[model samples]
Target: MEDEHEAIDRLSTRIDEKLSSFSTVSLPMCFKVPNLLRQTNEKAYEPQIISIGPYHHGKDHLKGMEAHKIFYLNRLLQRRGETGVRKYVMALKVKEEKIRECYAEPLDHNIDGDALVEMMLLDGCFIIEIIREYQTWNLGELQERNGNFRNFNVESVVCDLLLVENQLPFFVLSELFHMTPEPNQENDEHEATDHLSIWIDHEKLSSFSTVSSSGCSIFRVPNLLRQTNEKAYEPHIISIGPYHHGKDHLKGMEVHKMHYLKRLLQRRGETSAHRYLMALKDEEKKIRECYAEPLNPKFDGDALAKMMILDGCFIIELIRENQTETQKIDVDFRNFNRFSLKRDLLLVENQLPFFVLTKLFQMTGGPNQENVQGFIPLALLFFSRVMPGYGNGLVIRDQNIKNLLGLVLDSWVPSLKARDNYRKISKEYGGWNFKYSATELHEAGIKFKKIDHEKIVIKPEIDEAGNEVIKMGNEKSFFDIKFENDVLWIPTIKMYAYTDSILRNFIVHEQCHNNDTRYVTDYVTFMDCLINTSKDVELLRHSGIIVNNGLGDDEVVATVFNKLCDSIVFSKKSFYSEIFIKVKGYREKKWNLWMANLKHNYFNTPWALISVLAAVSLLILAAVQTIYSHLSYYKR
Candidate 1:
């Protein structure tokens, strides 16, 4: 053991070091919105026009306003009669460590200590200048003094300043706010303390010119179609595009919209966000035309650009984060639900134009990258669960994907050989003429075999003899159905709570648009033909062709497919025309239909079946007796 005094001195020094470290260690005032809550609405927590703190400081779109911060800092210095930035820099440096420690995560990843102090000085002063303007109500004089019209939106800036992610520590702000030579007005100090309350005192924010538009690529679900199932068409977690932009229940995801914009800028550094803003501005006419509903008058070009960029970036990030998981987003399991976000993305009404999403996605590509991955594959991966093909590892050959739903429709397409029967539209594709339910087909000595989608099979090339491609054998989409050799090969269709909604949305999308081939509709119509009653549902369910996931009972599945096509008045179907013809051929022979009817109807009653059995037994005994009598005569 050491001497007492020596130990005491060592202990004292350790205590001092610990005190210094702990004293400077600031509690986290700024936190990343939890991924679960962030998923709700992405835009509400993000800073759009200006980013005040390090979390959003380096974003390209928000970066354009940096010069304005310098300008405002100069204005602050001039108004306070200070000729130099020395004192302001010196003041912020003292509290830099504590200021940085206020964030939930380490700030070193975003900025160095010196740079952090400078940001604090600039942001603090910028906020002060905006408040000062409000205090004096001399925006015109200030504009005149600057000799340049303010290029940024004050209202949006103020709104950004108030964002949780954009906030600086209050002590840092308060200390910087009180640094100025105090003017005679007591209100100036009070305003500085309450600087976050700054908002443009105007009724309307005119950031861009207004324009009118019509004829939309994104349309609302018609009541006729939506009436089948309203929740399927509506977004539960988040909204996309202009139609469901600001619904209160779905508002929680806006922060994530803003967060990913920040994340996007961090990952791929481009020039000023003004580049994207101006690009979107030029697209105003097209955007207006794409939405079936008129652009809200309140949504000018600038406002629209801000909303779109946030939403677009948010969407891209959502897909990216969910890219690695199986059937769900990679999440902090405590917060994010196990179910996918595809429910919202797949809706017909809840869509951003594929072009808009592609535009932002392509433009945001990292400059150093040699080859950028196409958006189609990433989108396909995110929606693999709902897509008929699983959409994973398969080569996507189509480039004409119009939107998310359209991508899924493309994925549902069977191989060329599988589609040989459905390539051309048959006059009877949409007609309800020759049909046999699953039960009826089973009774006709036509074997009902479920195609296991989990195995792998090679679909031979239509043109090339030796060329073939591997496809889902056990795990396949519902669209691949075949009738051959007295057997019907139907792929499994996993029914979930959302399956009805997913298929309904797909059907309605086809019903609304004039698709040359209604792939989803034809598939649903084929299923409707196969499942006429609860008995048919039972047959399919028993064959492992219909896997129920949380959806209750066979009767519900029966009612679902039974009523699928009832709401559609005008629909053209072609994908399953060949399969329909083959099934018709099997049932067309009089013997098949008569025997199927006999097995289905006659054997179904107890007494009648017993009577038939008794009659058949008596006939067999009489035939045996005649054979014995003939044998006896031959022996004599």
Candidate 2:
């Protein structure tokens, strides 16, 4: 017994050693945001003027920034003295192995240990110098730098610094800042621990308590549409998260964001911004974990909290500006020209987590002072003009929503009960199959009508097996299409240039986070199946089912739907399955086919019906004359 116990203990010790070895190689905090996503919008992920970290290091286009980096490094060394520079380099060298582990893949062999140390020294010093410049400017000790850096375009640099791939660990920067402390700046050290606070928190607010979380809210777009139009998924005007933070095209909107942030702070009175920042600081870990990719360590609690506070406040203020209609004298007039901006905010890439927005709103007297409905309603109102057929009689529960795009899609989807009804009816009918197009159905004696002012509500039912069965009634909107007496009732959809982008992003979000309930994908797939050619588009247009909003020729619309559905794999269990079964059943009936043939061949139009009636009358007259003549001959 003693010998057996000794052997078991040895085996357990070996297992523990192996587990410890595996844990030593920690998971990476940053990855090359998948090539599939990058292929769609290379500019969205790529740094334009400056490359912060080694990912795009030494590229020909980014070589120009090397001079600026050296300039910043020289400035940093001059201020810190030679001793401080050596101290920063030594601190980073000690963390070299650990820092390398933070990358998703191994760095190039050419970038040897010394090369990496040199790169970090240069990059980290440059970053510290820029932040110090910004800090001194805020303190009225130094003037704003001239050249391109003075323009609003320089905000792009700030954006580039925050990207997941373009980051240095927070501890490295914190060490450098501490080694070269500014004179009489002891009290500000806590706020200056991260680079983000220098740019975002100009007020120098003190740190506060933290918060807990339930789960993550952010997600990556599914890879399904990566090969399709990249612009459909890319944000045009603004960026929200680290995914597309800083691009040259989107820099114009930064001024607007700052403007909105200023207005939001003023509206909240004193200490509101501080309170908002503290609340966000508490929930920092939850926010970082919500992202699909692990965030760079530089996005420490304070850095993330500042981002959430600024971004959340900007969005809330935009919603408020649109809803209140009060003409504030200082408001940027370009913001009111919202057709493009509103669409930009709803893009999957350009979104803050919904919960963060709600937290900011509630804390800032959004519910009490605003007298508005809620964040969802305010968002709906702001986006209503761009997204037609939405925000009307729609109720979105907070728990059900994931993000802005998710909220819009959830509102458009049918309720759980309605989907269950579809499944049950589809099962009862033995399976739903694809049928004819709108034009073919019309030829087969089917009619088309538009549904207006009807609300679709779902009711619950229980079966004998104790399972919940969805009993569909007229009160609920089942599928986007409904067939009654060969008449297909479809709601009108207005198509615009951004319509495809909205649908594509919504589908991506649905596929990524809500795969089980793919309501949007099912609807798009159904529409794609129904419209095979341009003639199908024309038929729907004539039937008042499709309203075009400068989307070009009808053929283009047909091609859009066809291409949108390309490579898309939809579940067989769809909300439209039952409607499809009914249409197929009606088309298969021999009596219905014969009646349709009669209608088409003899009574298709008023002129054709009149000709047939005249001929029948003439035949009756000829028959009477022949009978009279036969009677006269018989008498003779």
* CA RMSD of all predictions: 23.6, 21.2
For residues 127-178, what per-residue lDDT tens digits would candidate 2 score against the true structure? 8877877875631122123321311134456667877678776766777777
User: TM-score of model 2 relative to the true fold?
Assistant: 0.57
How high is the CA lDDT of each candidate model?
0.66, 0.64
Candidate 2: lDDT over CA atoms? 0.64
Give one digit per residue, the lDDT tens place, for model 1 in 1-636. 469989999999999999998876767898888888878998788775687878878775565466557666655655665445555555776777677678898775658766787688778877876777778754433432332222322445566777778888888778877777455332232222211112110110111112111324576665445555677788887888877889997887787667678767777665357778888888977777776455678788898888778888777766666655532533323343434457778888888777778788778765522122356556655666654333322333334556778766666666555555455545545355646888888888788788765533323122245433333222345567877889888877888777877777777666555456566777777888889888898888888888888777889999888877755532334566677787887886799989888987778679879988999999999999999999999999
Q: Model 2 off-target regions past 4 Å?
A: 1-216, 296-298, 327-337, 366-373, 390-395, 415-420, 423-435, 454-480, 594-636
Task: Give TM-scores for every candidate, taking all chains together and pairing residue i with residue i.
Answer: 0.58, 0.57
Q: How large an RMSD does model 1 have?
A: 23.6
Which candidate achieves the best lDDT against the true structure? 1
